[model samples]
Target: MTRNTDDDGIVVLGHPRSGTTLLRRLINLHPNISSPPETHLLSACARFLDADMTADGVDMGVLAGLDFSGFSESDVLKELRQFSFGFLQRIAERKGKARWAEKTAFDIFHLKNIEKLCEDHVYYVAIVRHPLDVAVSCTEFCTSMGTYPSTLHEYIKRYPQPIEAFAMSWLETTKALMDLGRKRSSRFIMVRYEDIIEDENEIMNSVFQFVDEEHGCDQAQSIFNSIPEIGFSDHKSLQEKSIHKKSIDRWRSLPSPQVKRLGELLNPLLAELGYDEIENTGEIGTTAARRRYATSLALHAAKTNETDDDTKD
Candidate 1:
């Protein structure tokens, strides 16, 4: 398939509450970039292409019908690619922008399939936040909204605790994108949410350059000048249009027990992602109980190390 430079788009990948919406809004401030709200368009197309006859106890024989009509897999994929590009291109054209970007946090899980649908025509920008903060934000969002979204709702059912569910979600999504970045180094870039809050101008300049767009510090600043209510996004961003560091360490407010559990769940990835480890002490329990817990953790670590040494030997 011939690629049109004008139709090249970007996919913003991240877990929920990981600053993907903020990144998308900033990217939209560029005159040449048109990033709409969460559409889940690429994932939708991927599902359609992979649909089978017995999905969800329903007869989704669309692919079979296409095959019966003499369309090859490549033929259907080509048509879907054209349709996807044309749909987004028309959006960009209407907005008087040369490029379009899509942000659906759940799309991180389906990236391998989405990449096949869009092939090499899309650039990926993955924005990640500390998992503990992400878990805290997810809990707060669910509490305030009075309902859990499908993804979080499902995760909540699987894990004994809500924070663990969110931490696992963050780990899986961030790990998937990070692995992809290694494979597609030239086409993928990761933006840490903390960096954006700490240095907006420099971080956004690198982001714009990643997508082959000019950096306009003035336009980027315009994000705080106005807030557009986007659907399926962090509404807190709409409420507080300005970037600040207040939420950077929100997990600290969680009780020590919860914080310790999160540290156990996310410490390695947190360190790998260059965030400081969550301190597991403070307000956890009585002094004696805390010492027992610490000693147990040490014993477990020693046992694991012994196993590793045995395997090496």
Candidate 2:
């Protein structure tokens, strides 16, 4: 079995269906590289911030006051990250590889913390996809999974928000990283999701070359060549027709009205991202402004969650 180095690891971050999984599968095939299953460290940290923070229903602010740092620096979190890395490293080494990669979309929300945990720079490979498509898939999942919100209006009438929340956050999170990378472009390497599906070889080779030169790793072709032609569940064949591309975009089939609303909500971010509507869909400037106003209303609703303990009372 090969024990891989913590150095030269890479992280793929973005909204789901943005090709992070595909990219990780491709990169982990490199001989000098290793990558683990989606460890979701960044997602865990995001949960600490944006979602439920504890079994006791305490806010993250309260937890911080009790000194999460004391817990953070303790053996628990360190061991968690290390075990996650080391476990994957062992798997890669047994496969005769030298480096490892991890792909988790929600990790971008806690990029700073992930960087600190690694303490060694890991290049971020950000992934992005069409919000309309993502929203449709997410919405359908709610129906299929029997997790639909109780009310038609997810905001005031029901719970768990909507599939649009994921779509909205996906745009905001990508924008935040793009904003950071725009300032520190040297530290960031970006690859578009379309580049993978549309220009696979070119994008893959360029990524391999960049990681090699950037990390000064030895030749990595052995691992690169081992990537299954068309990945599926472990026991499955990699044939094109047999392969399940169930994950591909299907939002085009949505009702025109709903699709239009989705486009309106995501238009600014999409346009700013150089994404055009497939059939010249999506709203323009005014629609994006409306999204902001809607977001402000949601923000006020969230503010009501605060307690007296959270206040300076």
Candidate number of the best lDDT: 1
lDDT of all predictions: 0.80, 0.58
For model 2, residues 1-313, the per-residue Cα lDDT tens digits are 1223345667677655455665666676555776645666555653443424678876555235435557544354466566656665676777787666777644665655555455434556667777666666556645665764332233213224465565665666678768756754644577776656665667777776656533332333343345453322211112223213455566677655556666666777777777875454445476876887799999887886565447856
lDDT of 1 by residue, 1-313 (tens): 3445844688888888998888989888888888887777887886675654564565355556787889876788778888887777788889998888888777876777787676666788889998888999988888999988786777789886888889888887788888888977877899899999888789989988877777965555577777574566667776775788998988777667777866877888888889888876755457867797899999999999999999999
Clashes of each: 0, 13
lDDT of 2: 0.58
By TM-score, the best candidate is: 1
TM-score for candidate 1, please give it. 0.81
